[model samples]
Each structure stands twice: as structure tokens, then as C-alpha cells.
Target: MVSSKLENEPTGKKLPRIEIRMLSFDLVERVEIARLLTDAGYSVRNELAANFDRFESRVMDDDWDVIFVDARVPYDSVSRALDLVRAIGSDVPVFALVDSHQENQADLMELGIADLFTSDDLQRLPGIITRGLEASDDRKIAIEARRLQNEIEFAGDERAVLAEIGRLVSSSLDIGQVYDQLVEQVKILIPLETAAIAVADVASDSVTIEYLSGRELPGFDRGRVMAMSGFTSINQLPQFVFVFDTELMEQMRTEFPGIRELLNAGVRSVMVAPLVHRDEVVGFFATGTSTENAYEPEHVAAVEQIAAQISGALANSRLHIHISRIARERETLIQIGRDAAAAHDLQSLYGSVFKNLKNLLPVDRGVIALKGEDGKSLAIEYVEGLDIEGLRVGDNLELLESSTAVLTGSQPVTVDNAANREPFDLTDGKLITAGLPSTMRTPLRARDSIVGLIAVSARDDRAFTQDHLSALERVSNQISPVIESLSLLNQVQSLAAAVETTLDLFAITDLQGVTSYLNPAGIRLIGLEEGASGVGVDLKDFMSPEQAEIVSSIGLAQASETGGWQTEISITPRNSERPIPVELLLVPVRNPSGGPGREVTTVNVFMRDLRDREALQVELREFVLTVSHELQTPLT
Candidate 1:
């Protein structure tokens, strides 16, 4: 019959379960031991083995809190059972039950026994098992505490490194310096065989390796540019990627050919984090090692933090560069305006414009065209760095699709590839033939009308961007009015040249009768000295007082009323005392809008001296009178 555990024991508490493995040759001894452990308020499962084979099998098959051996069994057998338990590497406590005279204490102790139990003192076995199990629990707790301590230290070190990296990012806007420091700091936490930072250009769909360090990688180096489609696919990465072994590296080789280079350089692990700013991934931060499974989850988290810091620094750097470039562009624009205003002619103005524009744009060729007088075509006024067969200065080009678009859109237009344009204009065709592929054109507007177009071209495709176009538009707005003014001035200069050579006396005066200009003939007719200007003289000073009154009251009044007046008038010469007769023509020049109630700008006076015609009439009269007298005397 099985002996049950004592129910009404001391302390009135439930017993604990104890699993024991015992090696014994006698059934009586195993049953006695089992009964003692059960009566001590312990629930016990005892496995009794009678042979070494059985004992070794029990030791290998199941786990026990303790093992027991009867010392009465052959000394060698007991020793062998203990040796088997030791060889299997079990930590179970092995206790030997001995007769008091069976003296093998020193030998059993040498064989690694936990304790000795005499048959008389077998009541202490339960307490010994409790002590042994308690010691095991303490060991487990110590091991877990050590693990937690290591983790805390690692966290502290990681935080310190992250703080250092954050400080580096904040202290420098130079990304190169930041990257160099970042690699050094990250090395404290993660082993690195290769490190790189690449910036993405979304407009061009490309990635350029901006910074590279560590082991040299073939086909992956500083300043290397690769298309984003089949390359690293950095633009498509989600937060971070870890290629932790050679097998994973090979699996990623097809999608990311850059991985092959890493593998060739003996790299077996890689960690990549996207550099994100303002919810956009602007670039990537990557690190690799030659050891497989070199990075853990915590290392990945650290790299992500580093990448975030880099992203912020890169954004600040880019913003700084952008602002600096804008400030420079603004200064350049101011200088261009000054050059435009100070230029004396269109050629000089174009030269200055071209020179100043180079500071802001990549211009390989430039052209300026004005709307034709007919308004259906454009006349090429200025051309620089462009030499096409049929296109030259003073050449007429029909309004084509590209130029028409600039005028109609009333904004800047960009041709990314001049060679790819359909229905190409003469300018586009010429540009393609010249291997110039990029072009930006902006309309020149003045007084709310599209007056002309200014264009710039480059040798590379997609060389000009929206920013460049915007800059060009700003320049166009600044110089368009000046161009119009210059053109008008040129026309006025030409008209003045023609008027200067005419034989008739021409004089211009303000509405107050103050003369502002007098041509050569007018100067000679009024008897002014050679090389003397007639400006600031009163028009009435050249006429007799009576004639000045009539001209001021009647001639000026009629000219203002009917747009012109013509009559014979007497004008006293400055060097002659006699008054000379002349035919006077007065014309009123009105403001831009000439209608009733319009303001007069100036009065133009044209005069032809009549002295020679009067002298000829006197000669003819004298000859006729002499001939009549002669004929009458002959008749008497």
C-alpha cells in the first residue's frame, strides 16, 4: 500500500511536491525512504532503479529536484551512479543514505555528492531538499539581474552617443563635417566596415553619393550618381532595412545592385535608414559590416536616430544654401538693373545683361528678339554665342510655336530638350543642330503688352529648372521697359538726324514760346553765329514786334485749333538791322492722345526766307521799265 502524505501535520498547510530519483537494490529501502518523505508534509514521486543501466536511463529521461543512493549497495555502484549524474551535467543534488560504519564519506565527497544521510538521521532529508532547491532559485535570480544590468548600461551608452551626435548636427551646417563626425560616433555602438550617405534628386530621379568612408567599394564611391529605379531604391525604403547575412544580401542583390559591391568587399550585414525631413525621404544613411548578424534591434534603433539627426542637418544645410543663393541672385539682379540703366545703347546693354546673367544661370547662348512693326513676326535684335546659318542680327523670324507660347502664356517657358521638340521653330532647330538642348524663354512685357522675348539656352538637357525660369522672368520684367525706351530713343535719334540736314528753318519751342532746339538752317536764317545753340531763346525774339504779336495771338491760336498754320511773316535777323520776309508754318505737337482738350507738348516752326525771290522780282521790274522807255523813245 502507498503511504499518503500527512494531512493533519504541523502548521496546517498544504505540502509541496518533490520529485526524487533513487538508486537502490532493495525494495524495502526505497519504500522506507518514500514513506519518510511523504509523512514529512511533502508530496513525492520517487523513481527506484535497481541497476546502473536503469539509474542512468532515469537520470537521462526525466528531471528531478534531488537524487538518492543507498550506501549499502556496492560502493562502486553508488559511485558509478553519481558519476553518471555528473557526466550528464545535471545540477540535481545527490544525497547518499549510509550506515554509520560504512565509511566512504571522503570518497563520495570527491565524487561530488551534495550531502550524506545516515539511516538514523533520514528524517533530515526533507529539509535538505528544501535547502538545495532554494539555492537553485537564488542562482537563477542572480543571472537575470546581471542581464538587466547589462541592458541598462547599454542603454546609457547609447543615449550618450545619441546626445553627442545630436550636438554635432546642431553645431554644423556643413553636412560633410556632420557625416564625418557621425561615422565616428556611430562606430562606438555598431561595428562598421563601410559607411555612406547619399542624397536623392527627385527632379532627376537619381541619387548621388555625397559622402563615403571606410572600406573602398567598387562602383560605389563619393560623387557617384545612379538612377533611382533599379539602384538602392532608397526612395522606396520603409523606415529602415536590415540585410543581416550573406543569404539576405544575395536575395537583395537583384533589386539593389549596389549590394553586390558590398558583398564582394566581404560585407555580410547591412543596415539602412531613410533620412526623412518634412515627411519626405530626402536621402539615405547606410552602414555595413563584414560579420554576419552583426547588428541587433537596438543597433537598428540607434542608426535610425542617427539618420534622423542627419536628415535635420541636411535640411538645414539645404535651406541655408537656398537662402544664400537667393541672396546672391538678388544682388546679381540689382547689379543687372544698374547695368541696364547705365548702358548707353542696346549693344552695350545686351553685353552687360549677358555678363550679369552668367552669375545666375547656365547660359551658353542668349538671344533677344523684338516684335516686328507688323506685329506678326519677331526681329532678332541681339544674338550671342549662337551662330545659325539663317539667323543673325537684324533677321526676321516668323512667330513660331515656342516663341508664340512665351507671348501667349505671358510667363516663362522651358524646353527641357530642344532636340525633342515637335514643329520646332527656327531657333529650336538651330539649337538642336548646335547640340544645345536646354532652353528657357520669358516674354518681355511693357505697359501691359507683350513687346518681345528674351531666351537663354544651355548645352545639357534639363539644365534649366523652374527656379531658373523664375529668375529669368524677374530679369525680363526689370529690363523690358528699358528695352522699349531704348528702341524709342533710337527712332527719335534717327528722326532728329533727318531733320537736322533739311534746308528749311526748323525750330521747336515749348507752349510758352521758349525755343528749345534750332536746326542748322534755322540758326543761319536767324543770323546766329556758327556753332552757337539756339536753345533757351524766345521764338518771338527772332520776329519783329508787330509780327511777334500776330504770330503769338493768331498763328499760335490757329495752329492749336487746326493742328497747323501757314502764312507769310517778317523775321528780324539777329545781325541785320532790316527785317526779312519769310513764309512761316506752325505745327502743334500734342501729347500721346491727340483729340479735343488734349495738352500740347511743343510747337514746331518751319520757315523759308523770301529775300532772293523779292530781289529777282525787282530785277525783272527794272529791266521791263528800261525796255519800255527805250521802245517809246524809238517811236518818237
Candidate 2:
């Protein structure tokens, strides 16, 4: 049958469209029901239930907000149609329509009828439908509110976990302790069966596992160093890498073999966040689980937050370590200086140097070589560790590639593999033969000149780093001056010994005529005790008035201009009544690069006693006179 179409006209308020199905045997009653619902702002479809097929087809065709069945229809047909609605799992409220008060209201309710009404009460249908829909909307609102409350609580917990992690990171400079606490806090946020921190070593181009928790993976434990090339490049990774399944893990396995151990440890999923500081990736924070697809977007985000906090703390700890190391190196340098100053001999000085240098750098073998007198060869002053057949402490070694390079460049040189390079001298060949492959050498510079070289070696290749080279260079710079000063002191001591034993009087007087040093001979010539020091005596005290006047007027002036002056003088001896005649020479001692205008620092006085020579000459003349007088007497 063709259903009547009815449309609601526009009103002051918009109302929700409600669809209703009408069941009746009479076509007149169906049209009446459709008109009433249409006027009341509901869309309606009418179904005839003369037989079950017609009623079931209409009910299954559309989703209805309400189903209306008239009691005038055959009781059996209405009952069967209600049964059909219930069998289809439709929750549409069903209202039974009665023309007379003949049907039992209780029986209709038992059959799942929503309400009982007749043609007189047909007007109340719209109000009943409105209240039902309002009640349904209220239930939906309550469900959504509970879901939002649960989400808010979950977010609050996550924030609490992050705040605690931040607190842990800021609490200590000890990185290990902070990491341990950090992993525990992270476990609360993510379902982690394993967690680890790997630190990258930029100098060595390697990564080392610094901390591990949970299941231990073989060959990938803490302190294990692996080449950085064995893992995925940190720069290419996202903020956090999430290997959610075995498929993705397999895809990443080819480039990162380090993850294979995780798989073997029953870790099927993983999340990794790179620890970045100052825009550079320095390490990684990783978490894994035994269940595939265990990590969610929220878990990835949590790890990233933790990684950022850890990165800042790790950077601070590393900086602290670096500064402490520098402080220790400075202290080592100071100790080396003290050692050099207190050393009594060359051997003691070298021993002190080696002992102090070991604190700053690796020194399995140490050698100290100074330039020879000829300036063409280096004499080994000290050697440790290497034992060569012909190489000894006093052996002279020709300037070779390594030492020459250090001298010429005035910088440190490092040989990662000494055996791989061609030997330039016997010392280099001996080092290679001794199985020492790594070496660092720096020039020992003194007074703006390369005086020697200091070298250290190790048995392992690539054992020394640029920092070691720099440390050796600093040590060389300090040691060079001490060595030079010691050499000058030795020379001065030998010269003083010779002057002390000479018979000729040697005296050093300041420009003001005060004696600074009088050698033993000079002291004896002045009639002082053998062990007496003449350091505070005046030069004029032991000279005659005329000689003192000559020295004050002409001797000092001539020496200042011409570097030396000589004169015959008489010295009055303190222990004797007579005066001693002597030939005196005065020489001005000036700076090393002395010129005519340079100031004289002191005067060197050389005196030769003339009394003995004069006495000899007198005796010879007397003998000649006596012999001549005897001859004259005999001839007369």
C-alpha cells in the first residue's frame, strides 16, 4: 500500500525529527495516526498487520523511534508483530492503541509494550517521545563526563611522574645515582622490561653502555664499548624511535646490530630517545618490553621528556668532570715545578719529572734528550723502559724525523703506530723493536730556543690522545728552563773552583769599590785568615794611599772605557809592617751582550806579587858588582 506523506511546517523553535511506525488493519485509522504524529512534529510510517509478512517487512525496513500497534487489529496478529519487534533487538518504545477498554494493560506491559492508549489519548504520544529522548541524552552526557574525569586523572599522574624525574635529575651531580633513580621513575610511566643509557665518546668515535637495569643482555652489559657505526645514526632518528613490532625491529636491525641482543633477551618492542645537549646528541636513553606493540604514543612522549631532563644533567656532570680534571692537571704542573726546584742533581730531576708526568698522561716509556755541544746531535740524558743494545744514557743520537719535527715545528707530535712508520733514527727503530707503537713527543724550549725533546711511549697503538700530547707539551715547557739553569750553575761552580786554587789574586768588586768575592789566593794576599770571607771588605782598605788614589781616579775610569787597565801598586798587609809591591789589572764585568755604553756590574782584580821578582833582580846585580870589584883589585 502507498503510505500517506506528511510534512511539519516551520515553527518558532527547531525540534528534533522523530520517526514512528503505525500498525493497524484499517486504512482510515492509519491515515489518522500519521496525520496526528505529523502535526505533532514527528515523521510516521504506517504498516498493515493483516498477516505476519506485511508487518515484519515494515518493521525491518526502517529504524523507528516509536512503534504504535492498534488494539482493533486481530489480537493474534498484534501479538505476533510485537514478538517480531522484540526478536529483532529493537529498543523502540512500543505503545498499544485501543478503541475500547477491552485489552488488559498488564498483559501488554508483560509483552514489552511501553504504554497503553486509545483514540482518546492519541494526543499524548509526542510528549512521551520527547521525555524519553531527553532522558537518553542525559545518560550519554554522564558517560562522557566519567571518561573525561578518568583522562584528567591519568594526565595528572603522568605530570607527577615527570616532575619527580626532574627533581631527581637536579638533585645530584653524580650521574650514576641520578640515572638509577631516573630509570625507576620511568618504569612507572612505561612498561619497561629493560632500560639502559649509552654514552658516546666523541674522541674515540665509540659508544659505551654506562648504565643498565632489568634483564641483562649478553655482550651488551654496562661498560661495554662499541663502535658508533654499529648503531643507527643519532642525527637521522626522530625525537624518539618506537619499534612497535617485530617487523619494524627487523627493518632497523640491519643498521643497528646492537638491538639484536635486545631481541635475544625477549624484548620485542623498544623506545629510544637521544640525549641532546646544546643541539648535539651525546647519548641515548632506551626502554624495551617483552610484549610486541607495548609502547604507545604517550609512552614515546614520556621517554622524550625524561631524556631531555637527563641530557641536561649529564651535560652538567660531564662539565664538572672536565673542570676537575683540568684542576688536577694544573696541580700536577705545580708539583712538577716544585720537584724540579728541589732536585739536587740531573738524575733526581729526571726521576721527579717522570714521577709527576705519569699523573697527567700515560708514560710506559719516557726519555729525555738534550742537544749536544755540537748542536747536531741529542745526548740521551735519561731513559726508562726501553732497553736497546747500543742505546745508553750518555749515547748521542742524531736528530731524527720525530725529534727534528718537534724542534722545528715547536709543537707536540704523536705517533699512533710507530712500527708502521719508517724509522728515521736508531732510537725510533729501537722503540719499534721493543713493541712500543704509540708515542708522543714535544719540544723542550728554553730562552726562545729548542734545547731538547721529551717523549713518552706506550705499548698499545693509538693509546695517547691530543690531551696527552698537550699535557706533555706543558711539562716540556716547564722542564726546559730548569735544565738550562742547572747547566749554567754547573759551569759557574767549576770556574769558581779553579779561581779558588790559583796563586794570582782574584777579586770581584762592585762598582762602588766594595769587595763582593775574594778568592782564597786574594784573601791570603791581603793577610786574612785562610777561611775568612772578604765579601764585605772595601777595595781601598788593603791598598796604599797613592795606589788607592790611582784606582779611584784612573783605574776604574780606564777599565770602564777600554774594558781593562793595568798599573804597578803597593798593598799594605794587615799581618805585617811592610808593604808588598804588585802588578794590578782591573777588568770591568758587564752584561753578556756588553757594549761600550753597557753598565759595568762588577770589577775583576788580578794582582801579581812583584816583591819576589824584584828581590831576585837585586841579588843578581849584587853578585855581578862583587865579581867586577874583585877583578879590578887583582888587576891593579
Candidate 3:
């Protein structure tokens, strides 16, 4: 029946062309099958005429999409052919020819055969083989589609996970909370025995653990954290891992020699990613996996994305916390300023500024100093966490000559590595000697003038960002005004000395007639006790009944507007038993201006001795009378 069907098939364009490889033990059967398939418009690669030893080579030379294995051939030969196909990694499908009596489908499937056809089913062989070829092509397409879909899904999942972590980090303003969430989320995504984040302490050339996840690191020290050498340094942490194999000499020589022992010590495979901010490698995240090839390219890529988010989040969180701290400190410092304003003692104000700064900023030690003449020395005024008696306050320390050379020169200065920089002192070295590694010094400036400086020291080696620098600048800027106010009062005291030369009793008062400045002459004239300061006394307290009323009225009018008055009044003299009349002159002293804002105004009073003026008048009258009498007598 199979032979009749093959013969009846027309060999024309209407019928599909099929290539057949017929394997048979008998030459007659091979000839019959070939003649039938050829008559059916099929090409045949018959191996019956070939020797068994050269059969596989002959079959391999032909590029048939399917191979038919005859049951008559030795099972070992068929197995060898299947092995060859697999070894070559060919996509060709193998079908087995079997008898109905020996229908061992399981055995054919186990032998790596694609399908089986019995001798009785020979009539349907062409169609079955054609369908098998089509099915094989479809399977290939399906497999490729699945592989591509897997890759796309993997990439999309990575992006989604990274986005979720980013959202989680940004939603929280708290740094510790963000870190905790980051660690937990990473664990949920990719389970690991231990994970930790370390940041580069650039000043010290070491990385500190910023976040930790999973199991506690074995042999982890609290006071002294775990550190890695060459491969684990901040500069090189971006590399995933460099593995070595001692058991495989070829692998050892080909990759990493003498590195097997290093891997065996809880360092089989290390996955590391760097955290970058402002173009700097601030830190790195690392995890250790026990399995070889534990981290693939996709895993590394995911970690890199997470690390980027962590870098940005940490930078933002730290900045936020820093701003919050600075704002609180600013409020406290402003309160201190208000308190200082009410004080007459400069010592109190200096104490308040220093105390507030030390309490607010994270510092192991601090010092407050002012620039001396020639810009050489820093006159230390206040200090904390230092040996006070050992340090001199007013002595010259010989600092930088150029204002531009100094870091804290009318601007906030931060020295991350202070010990390695210029104008830094190891003299007292309490900071350096105490193993302090970081230092920041900000110059106090008021109205563009460098009034003083504030220095903070830390034991940790970390560079200050622009924000921290700005915060310290603000703190110093706030205190500069207080220092300027004190310095102004000192200048006023020196000017008061020159005013003492006027014995006519000069006095300076505020807009309210409150005597703010009184020279030695005025103090003595008012019968004030010796060495008594008259800063708070009113003009009415010093003047006699008549003089007080006249001075008060004129002082009030002058204080309101730029007005002056000259009047005569009676006053009780300090050294005399009688009441002496005096002449008083009042003038409103306008502040020097024309640069920025409204100027300050004060009242200046000048007093003249009335007794002396009266005596001179009497003498002039007597001289006139004498001259007149003499002239009249001569005329008569």
C-alpha cells in the first residue's frame, strides 16, 4: 500500500518536495524506499550501499533537516548518531522506524528520538515527517520568544525595584529611617546572609559602615569597624569581585593566581557598588555570597541602580538634617544675641556665642579668636575642650599673611584635612594630639569686616560639604555683630578721655535725654562721687532746679528735631556755698552717614561758668564809667 501511494503521487510543482534519508539493512528495501520517495518528488540520501563504519560520516555530510534511524541498524549505531547530533548541537530532529510488534515508544523517547513510525504506518510517513518538521520550527520560535520575554521581564523588574527603592528613600526625611528601609527592601529583593554600606572617610583613607543588613557580620567590631585593603578601598570598590580557584590550576593561572585562600575566608564572591554624589565616590555598598557566580550582570546592574539612589538620598537626607540643626542653632544663637543685647559686659556675650556653638555643632573641641593687628595673630578669647591655662589669649601666633590665603577670612572656611594644611598649629595640638582628624574654621564677619573666628574639631575624618560650610558661616555671621558692638564701646571710652579737657561740664545723652556719656568735667560738676560712671543717669539728675527745667525743655525739643538752644539758668555749684547761675548750650549731634542706612542721633550739652561771665561784665562796666568820668572832667 505504501509503495502504491508513493507511485501514484505526481512528481510536479503542485506537490511539496521532501528530502529523505532512508537507512535500511537490505539493499532491496533501500532501493524500493528511495524509488518510492523519488517518484513522489522527494530527494533521497540513502546509506544502504555505504559501509557501516563510514555511514555516520556520509550522513553528516548531508544537511537534512530530519534524520530517519532504521530499527534494523544496531542500537549502538543509532545511539552514536544521536550523540553526534547532540555533540554538534544541531537543531535537526531524529525520527525512529520501528515494527508494531516492537513498539517501545518509551525506549525511543529515552534514546533522544523526536518521534517513531512503525512499518505498518509507512504509508503516512511523508505527511508525519512533514508535520514533525513544521512542529520543530514552531518550537524553535516559541523557545526564542520565551528567552526574549524572560530578558525583557528581568530588565523591567529591575527598573521597577529600583524605582520603588527610590520612592521609599525619598518619602522619609530621617536618615536612619531611610537607611533602614533601604536595607530591608534590598533584603526582600535579593536575599543575602549579610549586607552593609560603607562610606569613604577620605581624610583618613578608610570607609565607615553607614548601613548594615541581614546577619551581623562575623568578627564585626563595634568600636573598630571591618575594613578591606587594596580591592575594598573606596577607589576600587566599584568592581564586583576578583575570584581565584586553587583546585583548577588552569583557572588560577588564567585569572587570579594565589587568590584562592583569600576567597575561602568568607569571601567567595563579593558584590560591590559605589555610591556617588557630586562626582565623588562618597561610599560603597557590598555583599558576600557563598555560591560561585552568585552575582550575574543583571544583579550587578540592579545593585548599581540602588547604589545611585542611595547616594542621592543620603546626600539629601544629610543636607536636610544639617539644615534642621542649623535652623535650631540659629534660633538659639539669635536668642543669645537678644540676651547679649541687654548686657553691658562684653564677656557675657562672648561666653554665650561660644557656649551655644559648642552645644549645637558636633565637635570634640572648639575655640573663638579674633584677628590682631597686621592680621598675624588670633587673640584667643574663649575655648572648650582645650587646656585653657596653657593657651595664651592676647599673644601673637603668627598666622597667614594674606587675607586670601586664610580659609576663614571674612568667609566660612572648612579644612577637612587640617593637619596637612597651612596655617594649622600642632603647637597645642590638643586636636591633632588627641587624634582628632577633621577641623572646620569659619571667620566671623560684620559689615564686611573680619571680627573674629570660630573653629570646630572632630575626630572622624570626613569632608564638610558646602552646606555645612554655609551653616558655620551663618553662625559666625550672627556673632560678628555682637563683637562689633563691644568694640564700638571701647572706642567710645577712648574718645571720652579727650572730652575731659573741657571743664565747662560736657555731657552726651540719648534721644530720650538719658545721659549715656558724661565726661570727667560733667561728673565733677554734678557733684558725682569720684570714679563713678554716669552712663545711665538722666540730665535732670545732674542739673539744678532752674537749669534742669530749661535743659529738659531744650533737650526734648532738640532730641525730636535737629534743633539747638542757648539759655541762662541758676545752679548750685559743687564747691561753693551759694547758688551760681550758668549758661547752657545744647546741640543735636547727627551720626555720620551717606553709605547704607539711617544714622544714629545724640544730644551734646555745653555749660559755661556764670560767675566768671558776671565778673567780666562788671569789670567792663567799671572801665567804661572811669573812661566816661575822665573824659567829662577834661571837657569841662
- Best of the candidates, TM-score: 1
Cα lDDT tens digits, model 1, 1-636, are: 111122443777755566555666356666777788778657777666766787777778876667777766777887777778878887777778777877777887788888887767867876776677678667869989998997898788889988998888888767676677778988988788889898777667777778898988877757566676644544465445544567888887877776776788788888877788987778778888788888888788788777888888887887886798799789989998999889778889888888888988888889999998778788888988867766788988887545466465423223433434532454647776677766778789987888888888887655665677888888889999999778777765655665577555767788777777888878888888999887877878877788888888898899889867878888887989888887777777767444567776788776777777665545434432332222211110
Q: Please identify which of the two predictions, 1 or 3, would achieve the higher lDDT against the true structure.
A: 1
Give the per-residue lDDT of model 3 (tens digit) for 1-636: 011112223444443344445555445545555566666456554544144445566455655566666765667766776777677767677777776777556766797887776655556666666576568668979999998998898777777777779788879886557666667667545545667776565556565576666555443322223344534344555444322222332344334322343354454555667777887666767776555556666666677778888887777776787688777867876877687777675667766765666556566667777777556666777666645344545544456544334534432223333545455552345455566655677777877777667777666554344445566777777767777666666555544454566556666777666777677877777667789786776766445666676566655575436545666666654555566566665665544433443343666665656677965545434432332222211110
Give the winner by lDDT: 1
Residue-level lDDT of model 2, residues 163-222, one tens digit each, is: 998888788886777777778878878898889898776557677788999887776767
Q: List the residue pairs that clash in candidate 2.
A: none
lDDT per model vs. reference: 0.74, 0.71, 0.60
Clashes of each: 0, 0, 0
Question: Model 1, residue 521: displacement in angstroms?
Answer: 1.4
Output the TM-score of candidate 1: 0.53
TM-scores for candidates 1 onward, in order: 0.53, 0.51, 0.46
Worst 10 residues of 1 by lDDT: 627-636
Candidate 3 stretches greater than 4 Å from native:
1-175, 178-293, 297-330, 358-360, 373-375, 388-396, 400-404, 407-416, 419-430, 488-517, 520-636
RMSD of 1: 16.0
